[model samples]
Target: MELRRRYHAKAQPGQRLPDDVWTTDALGVLSSGSKRDRVNAELFRAIAAYRQVVAKFKMGDMAGNALHRIGVIYTEYLKDPDKGFQAYQELLAHYPGTKEAVNALYKVGAYYLEKKQFAQAVKSYRQFVYNYPNDKRVQDGMLAVARCHMETKAYDKALDAYQSYLSKHPDGKHAAFAKAQVAWIRTYHY
Candidate 1:
């Protein structure tokens, strides 16, 4: 790719480029051309370059950003949820304190939910709620747990999850939806 050529063109024997430099090069490649094939090729190139940055600077802020970007590229552009989940898992493992880890944690649950893996989804969502109780996503994470139970026709478990959500976040954004689901479950399902 032209982008890779440009980066290597500027490479010296013993020089360390700033993190922004690599990211900027990646962004240039991503927005360089309009051709789908070209863009796809550049995306792969960008992923590789960013991955190198992560490997070289394990604890840098850019590493976390690059990791999150890799996950997004895998999930959204390549349409490989498994690879995306793996990238997210790696981000969580390596940078558990980063903001990207919080996002990755929730996305793991979403991936499981998309696959109809309710038990795994519940586990991921519960982990998210437990680790990030004060996070803005905690309410949605709790609601997702109940939703997973309801989808699997586990009325009692769903009720319990919804009740737990309400007790913890009585004024949560999803309070009304949780209440409605609870009432419906009690009336018709249970």
Candidate 2:
């Protein structure tokens, strides 16, 4: 009862608190001079609460934005790659048609690339290309697919992807880079 009162009292007019605020505030409390055990307990509780929210909600861009924030926070601050990947994947699955989805797909692909998950990177980049064919990033996605294939030692597939990009976009902004990559790959093959 006291906790609810304190929480509600802090609410400003016309500003509704997000459900996660409870867990966040609890963490703040635990971190502020609380015992180590208390802090750990609060952290576990927060994780469980967040997981429940993630599971229960049918996410849109709003939730996707939240998930993106969670992913970045976990990846950068918490150093939890698995949780971060899960958050990103949730954004992709729940908000596939949103602007956030396009951005998330790119981010997930980049994440896979950084982790040297070349096949996963290609899969993500391909999906991005298929979904946003006319987007400015479409060319970049195509280029990334080729780069991922190249990194995974699939030289022929990389050449095909790069060649396709060059042919489709002769004067594109990334055309020179695509052509250069194709030339480099061809030289290596020869």
Candidate 3:
């Protein structure tokens, strides 16, 4: 409620526009307007509710779920990717043992990857691989690291990562692609 008001109806001069007109969804983060106000009002109330659950809760999974929803509400619905990303970070940091934490790891990596921040993406993916060694996505994360390297033309590093993946899982899901990348690097980038 407070955060929503600050960002929406009660927005300051800097936050609001010259005309101060906007259209939005429920959270008021989408745009700005009367209908926007109605929608944002509802959305803001939801965030307030989620926050309450998170603040006064002991159920790890429930708390984790609330945090995850907060992240989604901010990122996906409110159009605040940074805050949403922060929420995901908080979820992982506070609830490392939760399933939401696992998903947050991937979401964090994918967010960076989508921004073409290959190095950061690699770092995030590496965290996913290291933290959840036996996760089903470990191989995918490994391949993603290699692909990020390749995307940045770090052929040598890419080849190394690819080879590492192939060595770890000879017939894993990405084995064929890893082998192909390794061979391609050797053929051209060598």
Task: Identify the candidate with maximal lDDT.
Answer: 1
Q: Considering summed lDDT, which 10 consecutive residues are worst modelled in model 1?
A: 22-31
lDDT of 1: 0.88
Q: Per-model C-alpha lDDT, please?
A: 0.88, 0.77, 0.82
TM-score of each: 0.78, 0.67, 0.71
lDDT of 2 by residue, 1-190 (tens): 3444554676545656677766665656644544655654655565566666666765424566667767766676567777788888988877777676777788789889989999999999999998888888888899999999888888999999999898888898999888888889888785
The order by descending lDDT is: 1, 3, 2
Residue 104: error of model 2 in Å?
1.3
Off by over 4 Å in 3: 1-43, 76-80
Backbone clash pairs for candidate 3 read: 22-32, 23-31, 23-32, 24-31, 26-39, 26-40
Query: Candidate 2 at 77: error in angstroms?
Result: 4.6
Q: For residues 82-143, could you state the per-residue lDDT of candidate 3 as single tens digits?
A: 87888899898889899889888888997888889999999999999999998888998998
Q: What is the overall TM-score of model 2 with all chains considered together? A: 0.67
For model 3, give the 10-residue run with minimal summed lDDT: 18-27
Q: Model 1 reaches what TM-score against the true structure? A: 0.78
Better of 2 and 3 by TM-score: 3
